[model samples]
Target: MKKFRFALALALTAFVPQGFAQDVQPIDGIAAIVDEDVILQSELDRAVRNITTQYGDRADQLPPVPVLRRQVLERLILVQLQTARAKSTGVRVGEEEIDAALAAIARQNNLTPDQLRQQLAADGLSFSEFRASLSDELAIQRLRQRFAQSSIVVSDGEVDAALANQASGTQYQLANILVALPNGATPEQIATAQDKIDGIKALLDRGEMDFQAAAVRYSDGPNALEGGDLGWRSADEIPSAFTNVVGGMQAGQVIGPVRGPSGFQLLQLRDMRDAAGSGASQNVTQYQASHILVRGDDAAAKARIDALRARVGAGEDFAAVARDGSDDTVTSGQGGDLGWFVHEAFGPQFGDQVSALQDGEVSAPFRSQAGWHIVQRTGTRQTDVGAENRRNQMREMIGQRKLEDEWNRFLREMRSEAYIDIRPAAGVAGVTDGS
Candidate 1:
């Protein structure tokens, strides 16, 4: 069967179609040009409208129209650059992938595919247009994945050092506003950026404007429109230059105008959480479970799993029954003994089923991507995974930090090399030339 959902972090509201709604009357003019690609005025207008719709009651908190337009246009430009580069590098997303993503979106919003289409129609968006936009998003994601695989490498020594750094397992939820300076910025440009960042800091310090509001109005970062919310970061995940400074900050505290690869940034520590409590050991619960798998692609498979479930429910020896009926040749030969493994050893469905049962209790038949399964929980134990888990987490953290730095640099280089021209009619209000 086709996969029912995508693994992409696509939220219904957040996945607003990049294309215009069907009812947006066309304005016959080029808003901007990037290489051979041209952005139309109508597309810009629609993007602006979409952001306005997203903000709703908080729309009043948004920057003025001209500023918002410039922000949206820059985003569009980046998207175009990314998609074009992805295609040039042979990245492709098929129609089946787009269909699966659409189905996933529909399921997430509690709507059938037809209902989703109807809702899109009511909102003046065509289903086909939405599919195209989703395709671009998926392609760009795949491109990024490929880039991370090829460009970002975390060494074992780095992970070891991260583990050795005597720090507690604390994580911070952060937000930041960046006053960006161009690559190879002159003294005048640096002075101007410094002034802007200082002014923003002054506004935030006096509480004249909140961090989020100030971010929306003035930040030049990619997430400016989202109020510069960077989510959570562990000590290892933070940029090396700012780690010590951030570690010293308390919740609701703000710091910066600190210079980094991207620019001078104002950082805010919104909240913090202890990943593992102080002096607490990391332990994972493991389930000793066994399952009977009835593999097939049709109702016959479901019927077989149900019958096997009935046999076990009627007090037949589960191991004997599994040996006779289970299609998982590897485990079936061993009386279906799966051995002890962590909760996430198998997929979520298997873990949940096992976790829900008491020792020696069997679960109702369920389907997974593998096939239909009926699991029996044999026992459970808590195992300390502190050392192993910390090493793994540190490896991932180092990789993440590297990827962010590499990707930002890649984007800056791409933007600098691209041939871009913004028309006067595109409304460059409040935005400077060559900005």
Candidate 2:
């Protein structure tokens, strides 16, 4: 139930620090051979250690050694499979991108880069190893985004219905434990998955096992080790399979062995609350802005935008310069007029640029997916866009749900197609079942 990108990031956190080093180390025993890649026994040991470190005093809550090993190995296999797929599809992470990601990670953890390096060293990790892990993660992230953009389309009618049918402001804090079934699972496999889920449910119902521990031991979900935490989700983001039930469930209630596209899942309503602004006024400050976009390779585009910014700063008319130089044909002809838009109407990059500027002020050039741009904030006004904004929110939520479903199916397919051979000798007991 975890979002694709965030889950991808979490899944590999334990494995990231020494992943690359394990790849070329021939002396270590192989835990699994994934396509052309091998997951080393040493890698599994470090991953397990990292998980225990993460749990700290709660390490007693972790599953038995065998179950934990399988969970960690499966995660590592999936990461390898995904990164391989990303490479096949031509996704690449640049040095600059990795540098930016490192900084962002440091900032998020409230540590400067140097302090972050020190922390990693204290944990016996090297910055280069971390960077290697992040490189694959970034590539896989880009791959997922590209897949979603290409495959998921949210129709206007679907958004309209979602907006009409949903409660205005409710959100649920949910956790899930999934027993995933492979694509086109056989009747026997389905029954096995169902039984496993049912057993998990009985344990939960009888209070024989806590939900988080059950998840860590048995759930095949990406967030299993995180106690299968799905965090807070709006009704729009809930799959239709569970939407009908989640709304009626009380806090702490568990629902399902509910079969879904991915597998049999058990969902727990950890908590529920009204969305902060559900019934609040939708009045928001709207920016009237315009920009000159320069599309090219990153370096060239940045250079061009910077030159345009300097020209404008030297008393060149912004509109005249935009008309002559902007790469966005639709707006360039109209002197790059973007007209009126709210914060994030054009995405966070554009919004951040415009929002940080005063009226009539020109911004420094900034980069976005669309390339580079220098925006001028012409004016600002408070406008209510409640109806439109709600529709947009529904569309995003629906698209996200659909993407998760599709992406999971894709992963299953990838696993089915891959040549994976998990060795019993790799500390996994007699289990040798590998796709």
Candidate 3:
């Protein structure tokens, strides 16, 4: 069905049968380029129009047109830059990878791949052009992954630096919806739809309905059947329309029945916390720990943990104790050292438990559905200060700084770099209807 929809959309919009080139108005223009990749004015206009026309009405903090333009240009430049680097490094995003990404995008937007394609065309984007967009995104991901491997290590000193510059902060765990009215819907029709949704929300607010059940029944989202679960997204990950609601919300709270492009949306807050309230120091060395099976006998597991505790109490080397009596095979052979890890790499359940233990404090037996188990605090280091856990923040800043310092130096030394060309006829508008 998805494929058929896309094929149908393709047929109607940009398809040229029998291998003839799909026509685009040949506007002689090049907005920017990076080695083999180019960003055209057409792409720029499409992006802007998509943002302003499709998402703008639903936004409370819409960026001014000029600000939006500059951001779009910088991003386009970065895409080209990544393509140049990726090509040089012989990196490519395979078709399977592209298909997987496309599928994920469709799932996110509540459509099948073909349906998404048709929607894009309806909004004036060609499928071929959209494919190019996906290509650029994949290339950038590959390049960033490579760069991150060599450049993203956050040592204790680095974590300290991050903490020193850190200030108080907060964050939210939230999910949302953006409702866009159909092109031909009358004003009265739109209002009626919004009112209907709002009436349902009023019931939810007054405790007359279950949130997830209501969302599942009424939400027009891809995750609707799964109860509108967006899965632990950060405040920054939320669309600006509901940022304020998310940023300030407490756990189990909900907000909205708010105005949107197509109709009304209600945001639900799954959880929230003060970001800096926990005084736990981040400048701590992290060690990886893994445990293996000794399952199906709680009494026996407790006995083993008791014995291990006595051994360590008698001043035996902790690592030696692990090797001698522990069944956590991943660490037992290696003296219980899992590897170097940043604390948060462990999810909340494990992270909270480990964070509370001082170095060398063996944990009490805890029961998870998996089994009865013991956790040991092998070692600690001073690391992961403040927002260092914000994955992209450090590397992006480092990459930009590196470019500023060394790009010109490298350029001066490249004797065989190609000469750039500028043509008089290559100036024009992008591919949009003044979006």
Candidate 4:
């Protein structure tokens, strides 16, 4: 279950690559293949472009393609898988559901849905695509909750383990100024953005504007209206690129006119804390988990799961297989990788799988909500992989490693059973569902 933590996803934070200087041939990389469908390079690139265009302005740093490829694969696969599962479960997302999700997005960013769309449009994207994407995301979210409600088992022993195993980590709080860049933005346009950020830095230096007010006025991040309060988070929670900027800052210090493919970013460290392992210390506990998805034709999906697990057992690359086959489009490209999970947090099948796995072990294929999964144990840490931290390390190993795979299988089945077909053609104005 190490790789089964579906509930905790890396939120939408990424930097898009520089668009080709001239309109290049339509991207044609074969990122991966899943059964009959293949993930084209263009699709992966576009998704990254979408995330980056909107987040570049706020990100302090962005990773290179090869480095980010796995992550990209994971996310896209999850999206596709979940969308498919939603359809299978007879989960229909109408205009209202789409509207509510959009409203939630707006509220998250402190804007009206119309305003968010206007802003996105200004940046170059179909408001419809965003709506469509949100629907799939929500469907999976609900599916997981339902699974947890019915099957997740938490015990006092698990809680005690969590608290005992929790470790100290560093945390940061910051204010950000994000400037989203549309896909196909030119160098001149990007430079203009950087210069604008420089001006903001100057203004802050001169006490001309405060961080929060500026974020409210100019940042293109989700928390813009809330002054870009990302809340206290651990270093691991942030993009590795920003580690330096966040690491060196003093409270109230403004940092960055950082350059990114999407745009320029400015940041202000508002506060700091050392109690970063709070989740492990306070909230986590062991649970029994089992899941049922409302997605695909269970029989067909199960067949695929059998094939995938077989491949993994035969020494096939788990990440590659996941990227290529997992129905959870959101994270499939990420090689079906889940960052961390606890054993008790996963489904019963997943937990059982974890109990039987050894470090670096890969499981036979399993089915759950999304589709198929070839679960793997990349590595393990018994707290610190040492006797001194054995209890804590074991808990972490249980949570992050053992639970991840099961969670993935659960999600994959859910999404796999879902029925979906992309029009790839036309949509109702401002509506993505083709409704």
In model 2, the runs with Cα more than 4 Å from the true position are: 1-27, 289-318, 321-380
Q: Pick the candidate with the highest TM-score.
A: 2
**Could you tell me every candidate's TM-score relative to the true structure?**
0.77, 0.80, 0.36, 0.35
The Cα error of candidate 4 at residue 301, in Å, is: 50
lDDT of 3 by residue, 202-260 (tens): 87878876777566445554334345676654434454467555655667777877765
Better of 2 and 3 by lDDT: 2
lDDT of 2 by residue, 182-297 (tens): 78789999999888899889999899999988988788898899899988999878876898889889999998888998899999999988786754558899889889999975
Better model by TM-score: candidate 1 vs candidate 3 = 1
Query: In model 4, where is the ten-residue run with the lowest total lDDT?
Result: 426-435
Q: Write the per-residue lDDT of candidate 1 for residues 49-86, one digit (tens) a residue.
A: 87887788998778988998888888888888998999
Candidate 3: give its CA RMSD in angstroms: 17.3
Best by lDDT: 1
Clashing pairs in 1: none
User: Could you give the C-alpha RMSD of every candidate to the true structure, in order shown?
Assistant: 5.6, 5.6, 17.3, 19.5
Error of 4 at 313 (Å): 74
Clash counts for all predictions: 0, 0, 12, 81
When summed lDDT is taken over every stretch of 10 residues in candidate 3, the lowest stretch is: 9-18
TM-score of 1: 0.77
Tens-digit lDDT track of model 4 for 88-134 = 66766577766766676677777787787777666555556655555
Question: Who is ahead in TM-score, 1 or 4?
Answer: 1
